[model samples]
Target: MINHGKELFSAIVPTEQKGLKRKIYVITKAFIKL
Candidate 1:
């Protein structure tokens, strides 16, 4: 059970990180266009 929770938590962290990275990438592109 503990292992399962840890895996779930780890998986969520990466997806959240990727989401933040993608948002930053889009913002950067917009700023560059301006």
Candidate 2:
């Protein structure tokens, strides 16, 4: 159960990181347009 939780956490972190990066990129682009 612990191992499975660790695996799920590891998988989730990267996807969240990628999403955060994409959001930052979009915000930066919007700032550049202004």
Clash number for every model?
A: 0, 0
Q: What is the lDDT of residue 22 in candidate 1?
A: 63
lDDT of 1 by residue, 1-34 (tens): 6775565556556667579776556556545655
Model 2 lDDT-worst window of ten: 25-34
Q: What is the C-alpha lDDT profile of model 2 across 1-34, one tens digit per residue? A: 6775565556556667578776566556545655
- Give me the displacement of residue 8 in model 2, in angstroms: 0.3
Residue 20 shift from truth in candidate 2, angstroms: 9.6
TM-score (C-alpha, index-matched) for candidate 1: 0.47
Instruction: List RMSD in Å for every model shown.
Output: 12.9, 12.4
- Model 2, residue 18: distance off in Å is 3.6
lDDT of each: 0.60, 0.60
